[model samples]
Target: MQAWRVHRNGEPGEVMRFEETGRPVPGEGQVLLRVRAANVNFPDALLCRGQYQVRPPLPFTPGVEICGETPDGRRVLATAALPDGGFAEYAVADASALLPAPASLDDAEAAALHIGYQTGWFGLHRRARLQEGETLLVHAAAGGVGSAAVQLGKAAGATVIGVVSGPGKARTAAALGCDLVVDRRTEDIVTAVKDLTGGRGADVVYDPVGGDAYAKSVKCVAFEGRIVIVGFASGVVPAPALNHALVKNYSVLGLHWGLYAAKDPAAVLACHDELSRLVAKGVVEPLVSERVALSGAADAVQRVADGATTGRIAVLPAGAGAAR
Candidate 1:
């Protein structure tokens, strides 16, 4: 088996090494998956740098989510348990964590769907309770997580306002069915949302990029509106103005999607069912911009960490892409 391993804490490209390794055997409560595709995530980079909250032991693989198959050919999506991840030809995952992949999505798409779509679904529908016909504001609207939020926000019947850093992303946001797209490089978000809603402000803000976006969300949130904190993709974690929230009567909700996997696993399964229905209807699709070979994993992870890529990147094991 061939796998990419990071033997030290550093940038992904600086440390990740590809080599032939022995296949791993799954222990109790685990399932050994024949890898089809692995989703590249920001956490993969964080793990490489020893910055993520849960760090695997030294000399481990980095991919966090994968779409794989059981020996009997059951296609499923699962978390690539740390120290041994989905970057290899095979990986091990907790049996209970696996969810049947939707028939509509291929391996790469299925791999991309697990974390980003689940986070958007949980953040918007579960935590914020985003109502239909309300306004949704999504930051970093072209990136993987933000793109998922944009699609889910629209599927929920919200009038979405997508904020992107540049023209290319603004176009991507518009294609994702954002009713209005705001280029933060040029347009003012507060003014745009205020104008779009006739001064009522946005009903919900699905912000994955925190720093400046969080700051502006405070100024544009409507009374009793909800701002769901999905992540701090901008690398600057903002301290929200609680006073502002009180004055405006809006709520600040923090969502950690992984907690649902632990506290209420059934809810996570339920969300996957809903997302699958949307997938069947073509309402939600994981935008996979690149499908790299297993050997190309390091560069893919690096591109994501540098904010130089749009949509999800999947690492397909040898012949996996062609076989599909």
Candidate 2:
């Protein structure tokens, strides 16, 4: 087997080395999965840099999400157990956490679906309780996590306003069903959201990029509006002023989707069922912008870390032909 390994904490591209290695052996209650398609996420970069919440021992593979085939030929989606992640020919995962991959989606798209979509579903629908006809504001709306929130918001009948950095991402967000697209690089996000909602501001804000994005969100959030914080992709975590939230009568909620796997497994399963239903209805699809071979895994992670890519990037370890 072959995998990308990190020997030291540093930038992904600098530390991730591709080399030959033995296939990982599954532990008790774990199953071996033949990697079909591994999704490259921003966390892969963080893991390489030793900044992620869960840091495995050195020389571990970086991919956290994968679509793979079980020994009995069941195709499933899973979170790769650390120390032997999905950036290789084979990886191990807890058998109980495996999810049925939607038949309608290809291996790459299925691999891309789990974490990002689940985070969006839990953030917008569960935590924020976004209502129909409400105005939803999504930051980084063209990226993997934000794209899922944009589609889910639209599916829930909310008027979505997507905020992105450039003209290219603006077009992608518009195509993803955002009623209005705001280019934060050129336009003012707070002003745009206020104008779009007739000066009332947005009813719900889904923020994956914290720091400045969170700062602006509080300014335009409506009275009693909810802001769901999913991640700090900007590499800066914001210390929010609770007084602002109190005076404005708005709520700021934090969502860490991974904790649900252990805290409430049933809810995670239920969310997957709902996401699968949406997939069947064609209401939600993983926006996979690039499908690279396993050799490109390190570069993919680096690009995601630098915020240089849009949507999801899937790495097919067995090559593109491995995915149907």
Candidate 3:
């Protein structure tokens, strides 16, 4: 099998090298998946640079999720711990980590599922408990997780307001069913949400971009609302203001989807099943923007790190073609 490996912590373009390796054999309770597609994630870059929360030992592959088929022919989306080798053509995964992929989605879309949608679903349904007809705000609204949040928020019956950086992203967000799109570069999120919500504020804020967005999200949250902190994509983590939380009576919830997947596999499977139903009903669709060859994995990862891609980018395994 040809796999992309990183021997040391550095930029992915400089560190990731494609090489032939022995095919892996699944141990007891594990399955050897013929990887059809794997999605590039922000953490893939961090893992390459040894900057992510979990660090693998030297010389490892760094894909966290994948969509593939088990040896017995079951199609599934699988999430793995650090040292995730989904960048390879075939990788070994524990059977417990596998969730059946919806038959309605193709391989690229299935690969795109485990991370973004799962994170969005957990944030909106579990953490925020977003109520029907409540106003929801999503930051970075064209990126993988952001776009997913927009779609899922609508499916959950929330009126979504998306915040993006430019016009193109605004259109992309709108296409995902956001009720309104705010260009953060020129508009004030607090004021926009206030106007859209009739001077009240957003009932739930799904923020993956921290830093300035976090502070502003606090300002726009309705009284007794919930703000779900999903990620720090803006490159900075914001400190929570307890005083503001107290005065507004809003709750700040941290959503770590990976932890939930690790601690409770059953819950993860249940969420996947729900997402599958949404996909079947066309209520949620995976936005796969790019499909690249396995050898182009480094470039794909770089595109995600540079913030040049709108939706998910999936890498086809060695000999695998684009998903039909």
Candidate 4:
């Protein structure tokens, strides 16, 4: 099997290398998957550089989410804390981690669905408890989790307002069913949310990009609104004042999707089933904007890290171009 491996902790492009390795064998209660496609995430780059919260040992593959199949021929999507060999022709995953992929979605889209969609779903539905008819604000609304949040927010019957960095990203957010798209580079996010919500402010703020975005989210959130902290993608993690939460009567909730998956597999399965049904029904679909070959794994990771790509980027192993 050919896989991209990080042999040392360093920059993405410098540490990651494509190499040949023997196919990984699955242990008991695990499945051997011929990886049809793998999704490149921001964490993949951070993982390669040993900057992510979870670090695998040296010479490990970085992809956390993948769509593939078990030895018994069941098509499934899987995620794990330990880095599996997802950036290759084959990988291994615990059978419990594998959820049946939606038959309606292609391999590329399936590969893209797990992490972002689950993160958004768990953040809004589980942590924030976002209600129907409420107004929701999504930061980094064109990125992977942001785009997913937009779609999920709409599906939950919320009036979704997306905040992006530029016009292109605004378009991407709009395509995902956001009612209003605000270009954060030019538009004031707080003012935009206020105006969009008729000065009531957003009922819920889904923030993946912390730092200024987090502070601004707090400012724009309505009384009794819930702000779900999903990730720190902006390279800065900000500590928002608790006094604001008290004064506004809102809550700042932290969502770690993997923890739920690890502690309560049944909840993970239930969420996956609901997400799969939504995908099959066309209510939610992964926007796989880029499809690259496995040999291009490093460049694909770079594209995500550099914020040059929109939606999801899938890495197709050799001879699997048509599958993507």
Query: Residue 139 lDDT in model 2?
Result: 96
Clashes of 2: 0
Q: State TM-scores per candidate.
A: 0.97, 0.98, 0.96, 0.96
Candidate 2 regions exceeding 4 Å error are: 319-324
Candidates sorted on TM-score, descending: 2, 1, 4, 3
RMSD each, Å = 1.2, 1.0, 1.4, 1.4
Candidate order by lDDT, decreasing, is: 2, 1, 3, 4
How does model 3 fare in lDDT? 0.87
lDDT of 1 by residue, 1-324 (tens): 999999999999999999899988888999899999998988888899998879899889888899998988899999988788999999999999999988778899998889999999999999999899999999888889989999999899999999998888788888888899999999999999999999999999998888999999999999999999987778899987678888889999999888898999999999999999999898998989889999999999999889888889999998674333
In terms of TM-score, how similar is model 4 to the real structure? 0.96
Residue pairs of candidate 1 with colliding backbone atoms: none
Worst ten in a row by lDDT for model 4: 315-324
N/CA/C clash count, model 3: 0
Residue-level lDDT of model 2, residues 137-235, one tens digit each, is: 999999999999999999999999999999999999999999999999999999999988999999999999999999999999999999999989999
Model 4 alpha-carbon drift over 4 Å, by segment: 321-324
Candidate with best lDDT:
2
Global CA lDDT of candidate 1, please?
0.90
